[model samples]
Target: MLNMQLANKYAKAIFEVAQDDGKIDEYGTDLKTVASEIDAHKELASFLVNPQIQPNAKKDLCAKLFKEELSVSVYNFLMLLIDKRREVLLQEIVREYQTLSNAAQNIIHAEVTVASALNEKQQAKLIEKLEESTGKKVVVRTKIDQSIIGGVVVKIGDRLIDGSIVRQMQSLQKQLMAN
Candidate 1:
């Protein structure tokens, strides 16, 4: 919980900077790139988060790796995290920043689970339906869950719309038992 709070705090600070510069999406993309690199290279991630490693060394390495890739503000933000010994929260901070960015852009992410993969047309239709229902732009991430048996389950934030065969069967069973 404390870590999340810290991440949110850091994310909000950088988000505001991005907002002021009118580069919210660009900053988000830069953060994502840095985070993705760290996540993809486990050894590099360990080096950055290792308390035994000196902050100067981490900052130098990061500068060499990202100085050309990231904007000045974002590169400085990375250095700030190293100075504060909060580099460990890089991923969480990036996630929180993305959440803020998405909300600001009036976009919502949805997780759609189905018994099998939806083809292009089916996926588009589902996205259209979700957008129509929510009145917000929808970004869909699809997952295949065989246990669903059939049908779809859509999750958006706190809400879950379960139209899966398993759920329907369970509902029918409950009704029959109540009779």
Candidate 2:
């Protein structure tokens, strides 16, 4: 809980800075890159969070690795995390920043699970329908789940619309059992 709060604070600060500089998108990309790199390399991630490593060395390593791709402010932010021993929260911070960015841009991300992959026309139609319903710029990410049997399930934030054949069958079975 404390970690999430701290991550939100740091993410908000950097997000504001990026917004002011008209570089929010760039910073988002950079933060994602850093998070992805750390996530992809277990040794580097372990090193960042390891209490055995000295703070200065960790900061130095971060600077050396990210200097080329990250902006100065972001680089300094990473160093600050090292100094504060919050380097382990980098991924959370990046996720928070993305949330902030999306809100600022009035963008909504929806995950659509379908029994089969949608073609270009179907994907576009789904996105358009979602946008019309939500009144926001909707970004649809799709996944194929054969277990759904047919139809689609859409999840946005805390709300879920389940139109899958499996779910329908289960609902019908429950009603018949209750009867």
Candidate 3:
């Protein structure tokens, strides 16, 4: 709980800084890059989060590792995290920052599952419908789930739209049993 608050604080601070500098997207990309690097290499992540490591060493290592990929402001932010001993929260911070960035850009992420991959026209139509219904730009991540049998299931935030053939068949079966 306390970690969440701290992550939100740091994320909001950097989000505002990026917004002011008109680099919200770039900073988000950099944050994801840093988080991915830490996630992909367990030893590197362990080193950063290790309490025994000196702050100076962590800061220097972070600077060296991301110097080419991150901008000056983002590099400084990494150092700040190290100094504050909050380097372990990088992944959470990145997630929160992305939430803020998406809200700022009026974007919503949707997970769409189908029995098979949607063609280009189908994808475009789905996105258009999702945007129209939500009144926000929709960014979809698609998954193929053959068990759905056909049709699609769209999940956005707390809402789930189950339009799958499997679900329909189950509903029909239940109704027939009741009758």
Candidate 4:
């Protein structure tokens, strides 16, 4: 809870800074990329969040490793976190920043999973329909789920639309049992 509170605070501050600098989109992508790298690489991540390691050493190493790769602003921003001993908040801060950016832009991310890949026509139709329904920009991410057997599942925020064949079969089985 403390981490979330701190992360939200940092995220809001960063969001404002990035927006003012016209780098909100860039910062958003960089934050997510760095967070994913930390998540995917276990040993490095462990070293980063380990309280046993001295903060000075962590700052030095992060600077050496990321100085050339990251934007000057991003590198400086990270150094500030290190100085504050809040490096562990990076992932949460990134997630919160994404939420803020999306909200500010009136954009919503929607995930659609189906038994097969969507063709161009289907993808276009889905995007058009979602745009019409939401009155906001809907970014659709598609994934294949063979286990669904058929039909599709659309997830937009907390709302889920499951029209999959496997779910239908399960519902029918449950009805038969109840009868």
Best by lDDT: 1
Query: What is the lDDT of every predicted structure here?
Result: 0.97, 0.94, 0.96, 0.89
The TM-score between candidate 4 and the true structure equals 0.84
Instruction: Write model 1 residue lDDT over 1-179, tens digit each, in one string.
Output: 99999999999999999999999999999999999999999999989999999999999999999999999999999999999999999999999999999999999999999999999999999999999999999999999999999999999999999999999999999999999
Per-residue CA lDDT of candidate 4, range 1-179, in tens?
Answer: 99999999999988898889899898888777778877888887888888889888888888777777777777788888888889899998998999999998999999999999999999999899888998999999999999999998999999998999999999999999999
Candidate 1 lowest-lDDT run of ten:
71-80
Estimated TM-score for each candidate: 0.91, 0.90, 0.96, 0.84
User: What is the C-alpha lDDT profile of model 3 across 1-179, one tens digit per residue?
Assistant: 99999999999999999999999999999999999999999999999999999999988888789988898889889989999999988899999999999999999999999999999999999999999999999999999999999999999999999999999999999999999
RMSD of 1: 1.7
Where is model 3 poorest over a 10-residue stretch in terms of lDDT?
59-68
Across 1-179, the per-residue lDDT of candidate 2 in tens digits comes to 99999999999999999999999999999899999999999999999999999998887888889988898988888888899898999999999999999999999999999999899999999999999999999998899999999989999999999999999999999999999
**Which of 2 and 3 is the better model by lDDT?**
3
Which is better, 1 or 2, measured by lDDT? 1
- Cα error, residue 138 of model 4, in Å, equals 1.5
RMSD of each: 1.7, 2.1, 1.1, 2.8
Candidate 3 segments exceeding 4 Å error: none
Clash totals, every prediction = 0, 0, 0, 0
Q: What is candidate 4's local distance difference test score?
A: 0.89
Ranking by TM-score: 3, 1, 2, 4
